[model samples]
Target chain A: MTAGIGAAIVILALPAATAALLSVLPSYRLSAAINVASAFVTLLAAVSLLAAAPQPNAYILVDDLNVVFIVLNTFVGFTASVFSATYIAHEIESGRLTPTHLRFYHAMYQFLLLSMNLALIANNIGLMWVAIELATLTTVLMVGLYRTQEAIEAAWKYFILGSVGIALALFGTILVYMAARPVVGEGVQGMLWTSLIAHVPAFDPALLNLAFVFLLLGYGTKVGLAPLHAWLPDAHAEGPTPISAVLSGLLLNVALYAVLRFKLLLDANAFALAPGPLMATLGLISVVFAAFMLYRRRDVKRMFAYSSIEHMGVIVFAFGIGGPLANFAALLHMAMHSLTKSAIFYTVGQVAQVKGTQQIADIRGLTVTHPLLGWSLVFGVFAIVGLPPMGVFMSEFLIVSSTYERAPWLALLLGFGLLVALGALVLRLQGMAFGAPIGSRAPAKASALPIVAHFALVLIAGVYLPPPIVTWFQHVAQLLR
Target chain B: MKGLDFDVAHLLAGGLVLISFMLLYQNRLYALLNVFALQAVVLSLSVAWQAYVQDANHLYVTAAIAFAFKAVIIPLALHRIIAELGIQRDVENVVGVGPTMLAGLALVALSEVVMLRIASEADVLAQEDLAFALSVVLLGMLMMVVRRNAVSMVVGFMSLENGLILAAAGAKGMPLVVEISVAFSVLVALVVIGVFLFRISERFETVDAHALDRFRGDQR
Candidate 1:
């Protein structure tokens, strides 16, 4: 128990301390090292929680459910920081960024990590909302770091839309407090997730229903659900590539985590509308919509951004399907997607840097020019599109098959979306990977370790499921249920 | 005494919803800012009244923050930003007045139907406040949807935040109201700083979103 508390403190404190330190550290190399070191330490702290007991408190909690997220979040955060160090150095060399922006970038990156960690561990719903808000604000500044016209516009759009979503979420949270007040009887108790979930069955079902709708729309915006997803592609396409990787790999998952927590609340209430169908419908729509969107994406990052949406849709749909196997699949899919997508970005970042352009039409024939990166990109595309012998394939297959068993029509529709997305991805992959060599052929100087590391992990997870990890996922899946 | 407390809270909240409507019809940025300020003031009053009736002393802090930050500082700062940008004369109606106002009314009605139906078990005062708050929130969104200028969009966002503050205050004994308000204040401050940094006027040569749209990287 003591160890659990210590891990939680370290998880939250390390990033916070580093954020402050990075802000003042003028030496870019030192700050970059510190960022990676802190992220690594945080990841270690999160891993420690795997052995520690659950520590639920007024402000924080470390249970089977959140420990998985915290570990995954910090692991990706660590790798992204490693990738960021090299990537940003390249940016500085190219004059796209300066030392000063690098300082701010490092600081905001830590703050983003801190906020996401806080959100994952927060026991109080209000605290979780604040943490998510902080995450949004930090990333908004980072998204606009380039100060380019496109970057600024993307940041502004993200800020405005994100604020509206957050405000609605607050209103929903207040309504939740109102609903819980009579039974939970006031102040902190009403807002505590521990208490709220315990008392929710006795609370007003109608209020829970209304709150769920608002919460869905609110956090749904953050999750890049269709119709509320206008800002997402732009933000991803314009931001620094490391931020793009983090956005796809970790931030989207955090928002979906919030939605799942609320869905748990609705699920506990017997009289409330089953939140499943609503999530399923929206999830299905996002899958089909973003799948079609993938074809038209002119920019590589934006194309992957749409793929992130499609993958998120599948995960949400799996969770929405709401059986042990489906939830288990969702959890696995989320982890695999995070690793695979970020690996793709690492390769894409190198590809863009080497080619001196982000436009898909401007660059082609990667395999001829840079064999390592070309092949890595190919591997990433194959992994992400759910090709054989990759982790994503395992999760997607589980989701589709499990969904098929329960609701065949939904399964068919999901299968159709997946196929469409797969087709678009393969089409893009062929053009970018196998065609005649085009554009500048500068060799990439950044380390390929992060990409190789991520893809290897995904590859191993695909081929075999270690029994212990399987048990962990199954345990968390039960908790989610 | 209890009846009077409810009536006073109801009056202030209803007034906030009314100013939200006032915010909706203003084509001029200055008028919209003023109306948003008015709404914030009303929101502060409603929150203070809730503090009094519930005797939740922490709420007073939220009320003060709402008054000082939203009602006074935010508007004055935005006024200076507009004057410096020289877009004070900009008229923004992405959807003209009649249709926008009509849409605003429909949103208010929709909120009333939604809130009242779901909040049946809550006390009458809280229920009514929530309905008014929801209307205010919806109208603010409508304002954002219809405004093309960035300054007006900021005002619209502030008004929407005002609605959230109202809802948070009305949910009697809601914890974290003060912290949430402070968090929001920080958000608004950052947004104000964003406006300054973007130098919306100098960068795009106008604060019009259309200018921003033209440079959308994806299109190229």
Candidate 2:
């Protein structure tokens, strides 16, 4: 027990301590190294959690549900840091960032990592809220790092909308406490997830229903759902590419994790309204909305941003279906999407750097100019479009099959959206990788290993799933129901 | 609960909603800040009364934070920001006062109906407080939607957070961690928004958020 607790503490503290130290460091290269090193340590600590899951305490816990998220969060965070080290160097060379800005960026990156980890492990709802808010604030600062007019505007929009969403979420959280107080007795115990879920069936159904509505909208904004997703495209488009990668890959999953926890609480109460239909409806809307939005986007990062929303929609819809098979598919889809999307972003970052523009119109003939990056992007788009022999294909196949068996109409909608998105992505890929060479033909300076590493994992998982991963996901899938 | 305790709590919570309406009606930037300051003062009093009634010492800390930060420091800072930006006299309203007030009234009615129906089993005092808090929250959101000025939007957000604190205190025995974090988030939000307000004005020569939309090329 003590060993497990110690590992959890180290996982939480490593990023925070690194963030503090990096803020004062003068060398950009050293800070980047520290950033990646600390992320690696945190990933190790998270892996250690799988050995001996800790008991649910007041503020933190290591359970089957969160261990999956912790491992994914740390792994991607570590890779993103490695990618950032090279990516930020190119930015400095181009005078897009200074050493001073790099200092703040590195620190904010670690803090963002710390907060996401904390949110994942938090057993107390209030603590989770605080951690997510901290993460939002850090990202807001980083999004505005360029200090350009559009960048500042994007960060401001994200700030106001994100903060408002967070406030609504807090109100919902308080309402949950109010609902639990009568059954669980007040003070700290009422806000603890373990305690609240244990007694949720005895709480007021109406209040719980109302609270879930707020939770859905509040966290839904962070999840980048349609209508609440105004800030998402701009944030992804304007921020540094590495930050965009983390935002799409890790932060969205953490917010979804929060919503899932609350959904479990509501599902426990027999009289409470079914939360599944609402999630499914929102998920369907986001998928369709983002798919159409993809056709009009000119910026590479912005297009991928919409793709993230589309994938999140599908994942949420799968979870909404709420059978063991569907739940398992949803969990697998999340991990696969995170890996693939970040890999795509890594490729996109290099493409932008090589061509010196994020505009698709300005760049062309990646196959002729930078063959390594060009084909990697082609592979990423293939994987993201859910082509056969990709992990996303396997999970998306399960989701569609399950939905078809239950709700044929909804499945049709899901299939149509996915098809539209696939068409759009393929069209863009043709333009980006095969047209007449136009922009700067400079080769990318960053390492391609991270992209290769991610794609390799996705491909392996698609072809074959190791027994342990299958069992772990199955255990969590049952727990979700 | 004693009748006086109930009435006092009712008065303060109701005053918060009323002040939110006043915020919606105000047009000039300076006047909006003043109305928001008044709302904060009412919020502090409501929190203090709950602190005493519930005898939760930590609620007093929350009350002090509200009084010092929301009521005094934030308004003064915003006031300076407005004067410095030379937008003190700007009259910025996206929707007219008459319609906005009617909408706010409708929101209050809606919140009352929703809260009273859903919270039928909760204590009477808490039910009343929750209803008023919901109204204030909805009104604050309405203000954000109707106002064009960035500063006005910040005031709207702060007022919405005040509603949250009110709800937190009314739910007797709500943890102190929540209160402190709420207060701290509000402070950080204020500082960040203040900086953005300056940056926005510097670029556009106006604090109206409409300028921001014009800058976004994707917006049709």
Candidate 3:
């Protein structure tokens, strides 16, 4: 228990310390290195936490559920930092970003990591809301880092939508506290997750139902579910590519984590409305909507942003199904999507730099011009689209097959969405990976280490059944009930 | 739970909802800002009254934040921004005043129905407060949708936040940690929106959201 607390403290403290240090450090290279180093140390702490016993308190909780998230969050945080180090250097060379912008960028990156870690670890629902709000604010600032007409516009749109969503979330949280007040008796005890979960069955069902609606719509906006995802593509396309990667990879998952926590709260109440159907319906809408939308994205980043919505849709649907196999599959799919999607963004970042345009019409024939980057992208696209022998395929297969056993009709609807999305991804992949080399053939200077490392891990996960990891996910799946 | 305490809280919260309707009815940015500031002031009073009734001293800090930042500082800064930018013109409306007011009235009814039905077991004070807070929040959203001006949208967002703070303060024995964080988030949100308004005006020469649509990446 003591070790777990120590590791958790280090996980949070490293980022806080680095954010302060990077703000004043004028040297771009040094700040970037420190950013990467801090993330690496945080990841190490998160890994050590996996072995610790569950610790629950008023403010912090370290358990199987959040341990999984913290590990993934920090792993992606570390790799994204490495990718950003090289990616930002190119932006500086091309004069798109100034040194001062890079300084702010590095500091905000650490702050984003800090806030997300805090959000995941917070046992108090109110503290979680505040941390999530801080994460949103930092990302809003970073999204506008370029300060282009579009960047500013995207940031503004994201800020308004994200803030309103968060406000509603806070209202829901307050409602939750109100629901608990009578049962738990008021004070800080009513706001603690450990206390609430233990007492939820005795709370008012109507209040729990109402709170779920608000929490779903509120955090669903951040999850980029359909109807609330307006700011997502714009934010992704206009921001720096590294920020795009983290936004897609980590932030979306963190928001989904928040939603799942509340879903658990609702599930614990015997008379409360089942949260599954609502989540399933929304997840299905996001999947089908994003699938069709993906076909028309003229920009590469925006297309992948749509892809993220689709994957999140699938994961949410799996969780909505809410059985052991489905929960495990959801967990597996989330991890795979984080690795594969960020790898795609990492490749896309370099590809955009080399071609000098994000417009699909301008860049073509990646295989002919840049084979190393091109092939890595091909692998990433295939992985993301859920081709066989990749981890995503394994998880998607489990989700579909399990859904088929439970509700074949819903499975069919899900299958159709997945197929539509698959078609769109394959079509885009064909255009970019083959055919006449269309744009400028500048030499790519970005490192391939992050992409290679992610793909290797994903490939191993797909083909092998690492017993300990399987046990870990199964334990988490059992707890989800 | 006493008569006087509940009545005061109800009156202030209902006044907030009324000002939210006024916010939606405005066809000019200055009028809208003034109405929003009015809502913020009413919100602070509502929060302060809740503090006194609940005997929770921490809520006074939340009330002070709303009064100082939302009511006074933000509106004055926005007023100066408008003067400097020379954009003190009539705000563009997506829907006419009659229709907007009608929609706002409908939203209030909907919120009251929802909150009152669901929270039947809770105390009368909290039940009425939740209903009024939801109305204010929904009306603030309506205001955001009804106006196309960037500055008005910011005002709409902050007013929506005022509704949230009211809800937080109304919940008895809620800790100070959440209240302070709520206040902090509001400040950060205003600063971010303030920065963006300047950047938007500088780049496009207008604060109209329509100016941004031309740059959408997905549009062909």
Candidate 4:
């Protein structure tokens, strides 16, 4: 199983690496087919990866820590590819994306899958940084594909800030190496997570302490933490919906994965302050900041971009208040969020296509317009806003409960932030999906399969988390602490 | 030879911080790109220095990549972009150079204090690298904040990346895994910038960003 999963990652990624040639050879349609097929295969591969070895290991073994995330990433990537299959067709029809650029786009899309997968499977800190940068760069191109003025500015902003984040992360990776070099010696082995972590105690406490700060700021920015989240909404609102969904649901988790891995290193040192308070503080700030901004979103994509920030804040905060219960909750939130948010984007993209606008005021009363898309949007919002029986509610409850245990005062702030966010999301959604039909109500013909697939996952997760999944998360939560 | 090694690292790292200041001082788009280019050159030197210090030859590739892609290619590309877009005229400064430098100085001091406090028990090299890194990061942010021109703002961001590379290379034998990734990221960045230049030209007639204020959430 482990071997199959490993091979699957290669299979999903190999086509992208080869598509550079195919793109140049003028076989655009074939390139797109290969790209989408491989992304789907990659999703299956990730599932198999989880099935094969759901235990942490010295190099590239799936565990509860990453099983949910890996699966979510591959699934989102697969669905986005499907959406892109249709979305790109429209772009081509409109002459927005030249077939030339479309070829490049598919190649980059596969490369992105490769990068995210590499990051998730990596057992070395440096490899993880490299993987993440690859993913960031791929999205930068895909986002700018429209080459419109706003698209250009958005893509440029994303590249600049994304580079800065990558730089910080690289430095943080180096610092982790510095912290480990003395104890582990100077070689490839020194950079491996299993090796560095095993010898973390003898490493310099001072280096570990400082390194953690850089790591948090660097990776946190990618995760869209406040004060550093300026690049996020712009990137999301401007990029193709597939890119937006992948960025929020998949790439963010990959960045957080880097932080958590380093957190494990710091935990091993026994000198780094629990790192909980700092994470909690940042998480709280992001939650509050994003919540307030959600009310101000004029663009549909931007509103959900802020939502990504808010949910990420909650997840990071849960980890900050780390315990088995909270950690487990954080992991669960991570999974549900990817499913629900991507499902939301699928609906948003389809709506925008049908209406010829993304302006919230223009897109009124989705239910009145198209029941299938409208109802999906409604259910997605309900799931996202933490309505009862949704998995988000379950995870958030645990986060608040854990916060209550640590600093009841912080819990009040967290609760306040969640409520504000809840109000904002539901309020806008109320108008956009349910009010009197506004503007155009014509529905675009597109595949409904991926949207349905994601919603089903969210529903199943909400209703019944498999016993094995629960057991996996519980053990992994303990391991994280 | 070893005697010159760490000193060279220190010099290259210090050069990065100095170039960061130069970034703050620039009021013209051409100057910003040139300074950014210089900064990238220094960054590669620092990376090469680490390769020497740690006997990690893989870092040599990182150094070469930084030199070729960041210092040479990106600067040339941005210069062409600005000139072609008719934005080669002096950039309109929202913040004067004097106060910006002062703010940069304050950021540098804050970084030194923080790095010193946190890494008191760390190796002297790391202590120095962390302080230098924070300053570069802050200056990059300052560039993003103070500059209204899209191109220079990107230059600031690249300078920030240079600082990170310097800091990363200074760590000595960190790993080769991210080395290739960093190269690929630079390539991706260039592609995006290329896409943006052509697209923005078509819409705004010029690439100045102040015009973008019109698109804010609350229309005036």
Candidate 5:
């Protein structure tokens, strides 16, 4: 167990450390190759974590919850690095990015991934908050990397909103400490999740209730839940597409993971208020709001960006329902959403580069232009829109059924929003992939391997459940309840 | 909980909330900067008070940061940015001064009632600190919403963060990392704004946010 954790740290640190070394290595290609190598090594470590049984009381353990998340985060992160290696090469060729900025980007990418892994693996709430903020700061800096007017503006907006959200979260953390102080006594012991959970009911109810509110709002913003989600679309639309993939697929899930940890705390406290309804309300609002907003998007990346918000909303809402049926769906949906959204961004990155614009109207008939990328986009959009035989569809169906059994009206709204979003998505997909090919044929030498690999996973997930994954999610869901 | 004694931290935190109201009162851009600087100094003092009261050395680091970064660097940077941007003539407001003050008063009252109700059973100090923190936060947000000038909005945000620093100190023995990050964030933000403001001035004669909209329109 100790060996596994040591390996995890090495996996995370190696890339960042290597990038630091790579920065001074005269050739940019060599540095990019090293970055990709480090990402693969991290992915290897995360995969190996699944085989290593966790030891109790360990600071970092590959448990049921984080095992899936870490693997998913690293896997997507690897693909992103691969794509970025090539993408940055092009930017350097075009004189858009200097070698110095490439070094910064590569280093920050690893740092961001490390922080994400730390957040997902953390055993303590305080540690989790710090890790997530580290992740946020790294991403904020990266988002502003272009140094253009819009890029800076987007980064500034993200920074301000991210800071405010984090401040609210710290207040919630303080409140949690206050609540636990009497029950667990003040000091390091009170901050640990396992310790807090065991003694939760003994903690003050009012403090727990209030703390949960702050926790929900704070982390909910990171999850890109509506009303508090202003910074998200801009961040996604403006940043490099690989970073967009990480932000949408991994970072949002990590934030929700933190919120789930606190929800478990609140759930353990018998007298404390239920977190279910508040989460449900916010989740539904985010879904409906994003769904309607999706139709009017003139910018392609921004359109999918809103779609990320909508899909995350669906996953959180499913979890908020908090039953075996819905929780199971939520977990599966999270996995599929990460894979598909990252894949979509990968495809989008290729398209945007080929056409040199984020404007949807500028790029036309992807299927004729680049069949590999076009089909990937089609499959990605289909998967994201919750079509049949994709794992997302399975999860969304299960969530609807669960809602139907409990609150029929909410199910209707969920269905309504999903359908509206689906309609807009299909419309745009056809517009981009089925129409006449008007753009230049400058073919991309992009790797189709990642897109194919993700589709295969989503495909397998829809048809069958690997027993270990299903069992793991069920256990975590029961813990949530 | 009932037996716990709190004297100076309590008074200082309350004083910080009272000064937050000055945000609504100050109309001139330079005066608003002065008020913000004062608020940061007060925030630093409160953190220092907590360090003495709670016997934690880490919070003293928070105090030094609050004083050094917020009180000095941010205001000085903002002062220069405003001067360079040529928007230092007077502050503009989307809403009138009177209604904004009235809204600010109502916000304070709402904070008191809400905080008192939520924290009714907690120790008196926490209840008071939470109430004051909420007021400062809400007032900061309120200032941002009401003011049209970008500089004032920045002032309002700095004031809000000053409140956050106070709340962190009040929590007592909370990690030094978050406090340090908060201070570092203020510094990072100052650099970004400094750059953005200079660019704004170079692009357009005025730093009025409305001018930014017009700049966009012209580009489009």
Candidate 6:
């Protein structure tokens, strides 16, 4: 028990300590190194949770639901920081960011990691809301780090929309507490997740239904769901690429995890309205909408941002299906998408640095210019587009097959959206990678180790499922249901 | 005592919604700031009243924070920001006041119907307070939508936040931590917006959010 508590404390505290240290460190290289080191240490702590889970307390809890997320969050955070170390150096050399900006960037990176970890572990509903809000504010700061008009605009839009989402969420949370108060009584116990779930069946179903709507819209905005996803593409296009990676890879998952937590509460209540239909509707709309939007994107990062929305839509839809198999598939898809998308961003970062632009029209012939970088982009694109051998393909297959048995029309629609996105991605990839070189042929000074490591894990997961991992996912899926 | 609590909470919450309407029509930046300040003051009074009636001491701290930060400090900060940026004192609304007022009235009606219908079992006092709170929230969102000026948008967001605090206070037994954190988050948002105002004006010589849209060249 002591060891488990210590591990949890280390996981929560190390990133924050790193953030403070990085803020004061004048040397950019040293801060970057420390950022990576801190992330690695946090990852170790998170992995330790698998051995001995902590008891659920008033403030923080570790359950089957969050442990999977904790491990994935820290792992990607560690790799993204490693990718950032090299990626940020190129930005400095190109005079896009000064050392001061890098200091802020490094610090905010760890701060973001810390806030996300806190959000995942928080057992109190209000505490989770506060932590997620902190994550939003930190990302807003980092998004505007460039101080360019476009970057500022993106950051401002994100701020306004994100705050509105958060405020609505707060209202929903208060309503939940009110709903619980009559039965559970007053004080902190009324707002505790464990207590709420335990007593949900007795709570007023109408109030719970109303609260779920607000929570869905509120956190859905952060999750980059369609109709609330306007801030997403611009933020990705304008900010430093590393922040974009973390936003797509980790932040969206955290928000969706919050939604799933609420969904579980609603599902446990026999009287409350089923939350699955609403989730499925929103998810399908996002998938279709993002697929169509992908064709019109002029910036490379913006295209991928839309793709992130589409994949999140699928994951939400699977969880909405709510059977054990679908829930497990959703969990697997979430892990697969995070790994694949971050790896893709790492490659895109290198390509942008080498070619000196983010415009899809300006760059071409990657294969001839830099073979190693080119093939990696090819591999990432293939993997992300759900090629047969990739983990994403495996997860996508599970989702579609499972959905077909229950709702064939929905599955058809999903498959169509996926195909449309596939076409758009392939068309863009061919133009960028196969034609004659049009931009700088200079070699990119990037560490390919992170990308290679991510793709390898993804590849291995696709080919063969380890026994222990499958059992763990099954346990989590049961908890989710 | 029960009747007095219900009437007072209803009146104060209604005042917040009314001030939110006042916020919508104020084309002058200084006037908008003044209206926002008034709204925050009303919010603090309402919260304090809840604290007194519920005998919840922690709510007193929330009331104090609302009075000190939202009512005074934020408006003063925005006043300074406006003066420094030399943002045009009179700003054009994306939609005219007559139409905006009509929309606001419709929103208030919608909230009343929605809240009353959904929260039928709640006590009369809580139900009325929630209805008014929802109106304030909806109106704040309307203000954000119709105003093109960055400063006005910030005011709109703060007003929305005020609505949330009112709701939290009315809900019996909400923890002190939530109230305090909400206050702190709004302050941090103000600081970040203040800095961005200077940055935006420095870059474009205008604080109009439309200028930002023009730069992006695409609209969602």
Q: What DockQ class does candidate 2 belong to?
A: medium
lDDT of each residue in B63-155, candidate 6, tens digit only: 888888888887897788889778779866879999999999999999999889888777777778888888988898998888777778777
Poorly placed runs, candidate 4 (over 4 Å)? A1-12, A15-32, A54-61, B1-12, B28-56, B59-63, B66-75, B116-140, B177-196, B199-220
Q: By the TM-score metric, which is better: model 3 or model 4?
A: 3
TM-score of chain A of 4: 0.95
Q: State the lDDT of candidate 4 residue by residue for A14-95, as single tens digits.
A: 6456556555756666766676777777777677776575344444645566666777787788888887787777767666
Which is better, 4 or 5, measured by TM-score? Answer: 5
The 10-residue segment with the lowest total lDDT in model 3 chain A: A50-59
Candidate 4 positional error at A278, Å: 1.2
Give DockQ for candidates 1 onward, in order: 0.70, 0.52, 0.61, 0.47, 0.32, 0.46
- lDDT of each residue in A320-424, candidate 3, tens digit only: 999999999999999999999998999999999999888877778999999988898889988988889999999999999999999999999989999999999
Rank ordering of all candidates by DockQ, starting from the highest: 1, 3, 2, 4, 6, 5
> What are the per-residue Cα lDDT tens digits for candidate 5 across A162-213?
8778767877887787777767766667777778878998988988898899
State the displacement of the C-alpha of residue B192, model 6, in Å, after optimal TM-score superposition: 5.2
Candidate 3 regions exceeding 4 Å error are: B177-214
> Which segments of candidate 6 are over 4 A away from where they belong?
B176-198, B201-220
lDDT of 6 at A115: 91
Report lDDT per candidate: 0.90, 0.89, 0.87, 0.78, 0.80, 0.87
Docking outcome class, model 6: acceptable
Rate residue A351 of model 1 by lDDT.
Answer: 92
lDDT (Cα) of model 2 = 0.89
Query: After superposition, which runs of candidate 1 have C-alpha atoms over 4 Å from their true positions?
Result: B201-220
Summarize candidate 6's per-residue lDDT along A330-359 as a digit string, tens digits.
Answer: 999999999999999999989999898788
CA lDDT of A456 in candidate 4?
Answer: 88
Task: Compute the lDDT of residue A388 as modeled in candidate 4.
Answer: 76
**Which segments of candidate 2 are over 4 A away from where they belong?**
B177-198, B201-220
